[model samples]
Target chain A: MMDFGSFLAMGGYAAYVWPAYGAALVILLAIWIDGSRRRRAVDQALHRLEQQRNSER
Target chain B: MHRFANPGRFLRLANRIQPWLKALTVLGFIIGLYLALWGSPPDYQQGETVRIMYVHVPAAWMALFAYLLVGLASASSLIWRHPLADVAAEAMSPVGAAFTLIALITGSLWGKPMWGTYWVWDARLTSFLLLFFLYLGHMALLGAFDDRARGQRSAAVLAIVGLVNLPVIKFSVDWWNTLHQPASIVRMGGISIDSSMQWPLFAMAITFHLFMLAAVIERMRTLLLEARLRNQRLAAFERVGTQARASE
Candidate 1:
């Protein structure tokens, strides 16, 4: 098993390393969330249009 | 390829692949993160700081790869007037820009420890900065015009012209003496990096590529739907106008 303390410490470069990884994770998550929200909005709009067409018919 | 140019067909294909892509992306990230953090051994020189390469290298590669895609798509849009090409190019900009931003930030983070400074105006770094600017410029030009087609055409031209920078960025370290190291993994000989480090890097690269594809497809779908909604609203307004005229 790896020592958790040394792993976290990252050989004294933890301050530099973790934040780089953290920033990447944050950006990736943000992109995913934003894309999902946009997709949902588009789906709702399309559904409303379909309902309107059905009512007209 | 041509048949898929139809938006309906394209959306159908995008929808089909998107779920699979998402699953693969999530799986890749899980495996990649585990390997990157623990499976790989530390570098003799950089020590634990070598872990940053797992993220930085992949982001840098994607930053260039995405620009290449955008440039090719823009060329198709301008030359053949491919229906979805402009949209593809436009959707790629922000994602590519984000990758560039990540690469730059992470590079700076790595640099501070290794080089004793956050940044330097070296050949490789400066060319990469220009790439980030190109993405922003493409996006800004797209929104600058009132007419959508005109805006797309203008941006497509900009993207194509910016293609010159791609090769420059790739070769900058080789062509000029700079703080940035020259190509290691992609040179004439075999990869200088060890097998243990290589696996995690490959995994991360795959993850980032899949994530980019998913994001682009999702954004394209949204844009297509918005276009359809605009047409529907316009049609409804026309119907109302006709009815009002008839009643009068």
Candidate 2:
């Protein structure tokens, strides 16, 4: 099992390096979630409108 | 591609594809992080600080790729007037900017330790900072106008014109003496990277691409819906006007 020190040693600047990598993942994931949610909301609204159009027809 | 040119068809495709994209993104990240953080060996010189490559390289790559996508879509919009192409191009800005921001922020985070400074005025670093501003300029130019069409047209022009910066970013290391290291991993020459670390870096890069695509598709769906809703309102207004005239 790898110890915490080795983990921290990602090459030596663990404090600066880990967070840089970590934050990239966090930001991209957040953007992904936000985008997916926006898409879902749009799709639902579009479906309702499509239904309205069909009813009118 | 034409099958997806229609907004209705596009919406259907997006709805189906989005979930799978999300799942893949999650899986990619999990696998990539493990390989990068645990599986990869430490560099003799940089030691643990080399771990920053797992994030920095991918973000930087995506930032450039996103702009290229924008330029390509802008060409499509201008040449063919493809129905929703402009919307797709416009929606890319925010996602691209977010990616660029991630790249810049993480670069800054990584630089502090490696370069011993958060930022430098070197050519490569300056050009990258310029590229980020170009993205912000595109975002602002697209929204500043009252007419949406005008805004989109202007933004597309700007994006196409801004393609010059991509080459500048690519060549900066060679052209100038910069603090930023030359492209060792992705050089046109054979991969200079060792076998141990190369796989995780490439995997994370792929993950970044898929993640970017998922975001773009989602934003495209929202733009299409917004456009459709506006059309619906206009159609409703016309119907009401005719009915009033008939009654009079």
Interface RMSD for candidate 2 relative to the native interface: 1.9
Q: What TM-score does chain B alone reach in each candidate, compared with the true chain B?
A: 0.98, 0.94
- Candidate 1 residue lDDT tens string, B1-248: 88999999999999999999999999999999999999989899999999999999999999999999999999999899998998899888889998999999999999999999989999999999999999999999999998989999999999999999999998898899999988887567778778999999999999999999999998888888878888888998899899899999
Model 2 stretches astray by more than 4 angstroms? A5-12, A44-57
Output the number of the lDDT-best candidate: 1
Best candidate according to TM-score: 1
Candidate 2, fnat value? 0.84
**Best-performing candidate as measured by DockQ:** 1
**Candidate 1 chain B, run of 10 with poorest lDDT:** B185-194
In angstroms and one decimal each, the interface RMSD of every candidate reads 0.9, 1.9
**Each candidate: what lDDT?**
0.92, 0.83
TM-score, chain B, predicted structure 2: 0.94
